[model samples]
Target: MALVHHDPQDGILITRIGQAEITVRPEPPASASGAPVILLRVDAPMLDTLAAAYLDPDEARRLAQALVHAAEAVRPATPWRSPRPNTR
Candidate 1:
């Protein structure tokens, strides 16, 4: 069986995966209240996006905030920095 999933609720988190991908799809129409479509895709194991969520903008924002807060709580003291672009 494949390892890891977009969210812990969806699959078991047994292995230590080094990579993941999160993508935000195009939003639904402003007035389309009933149209709750999948807005985010979380792909673990780095190869496929097998998990998704149909969250509205507000819900997405709240989830993002929670994730950031929890991440900060357990994050290493040394901040993670983006690599500088190579200049040739």
Candidate 2:
């Protein structure tokens, strides 16, 4: 299994399901947002594909574990930092 991000601006969302890899995402909008409200909207075809790929119990477990690990690894190590350093 692999991690996936649905970035419409970027393009396709690529990820691995069990041993197979797949790409799925919504079409990019014509307009852009000033304050990006990133939202992932997965459709039926993508859901069906994912469901079918993980039909096997063992495969599903493996995928779940992989997803957990992937999420953990991506977590920020520290809080955000300001561009200008604090001055006395």
Candidate 3:
């Protein structure tokens, strides 16, 4: 990733996601101190298409693992092989 924007008043970025968003903040009344949780949401919305979910740190970790597991389940054991070149 590149430093697209930088400003002392804008604050530093903790991380970035592709077509998705994640924010960590304390729950409930912003004034009151509470356990910090995460808010996961999609970056873009097509025709009001967006998936938003409130998840704790633990749940976030599990979600990551689940994503990996699901991806691996359908992932090919070997990489795709291109067709052989024609000798003719």
TM-score to true structure, per model: 0.44, 0.29, 0.46
Writing each residue's lDDT as its tens digit, candidate 1 over 30-83 gives: 575565443676668657546877786678779879988777667844687446
Worst 10 residues of 2 by lDDT: 34-43
Model 2 ranges off by over 4 Å: 1-54, 76-88
Give candidates' CA RMSD values in order. 13.0, 13.7, 10.6
How does candidate 3 score on lDDT?
0.55
- Candidate 2 lDDT (Cα, whole model)? 0.49
lDDT of candidate 3 over 1-88, digit per residue (tens):
3333344453323333554443333244334665656666544433446666777779978987998767766884458644658999
Question: What count of clashes does model 3 give?
Answer: 0
User: What are the per-residue Cα lDDT tens digits for candidate 2 across 1-88?
Assistant: 5666556677547666655556543333435743222223323454454332212345445665888767656773457533556687
Task: Name model 1 segments beyond 4 Å from true.
Answer: 1-20, 30-38, 44-49, 76-88
lDDT of 1: 0.60
Find the number of clashing residue pairs for candidate 1.
Answer: 0
Q: List the residue pairs that clash in candidate 1.
A: none
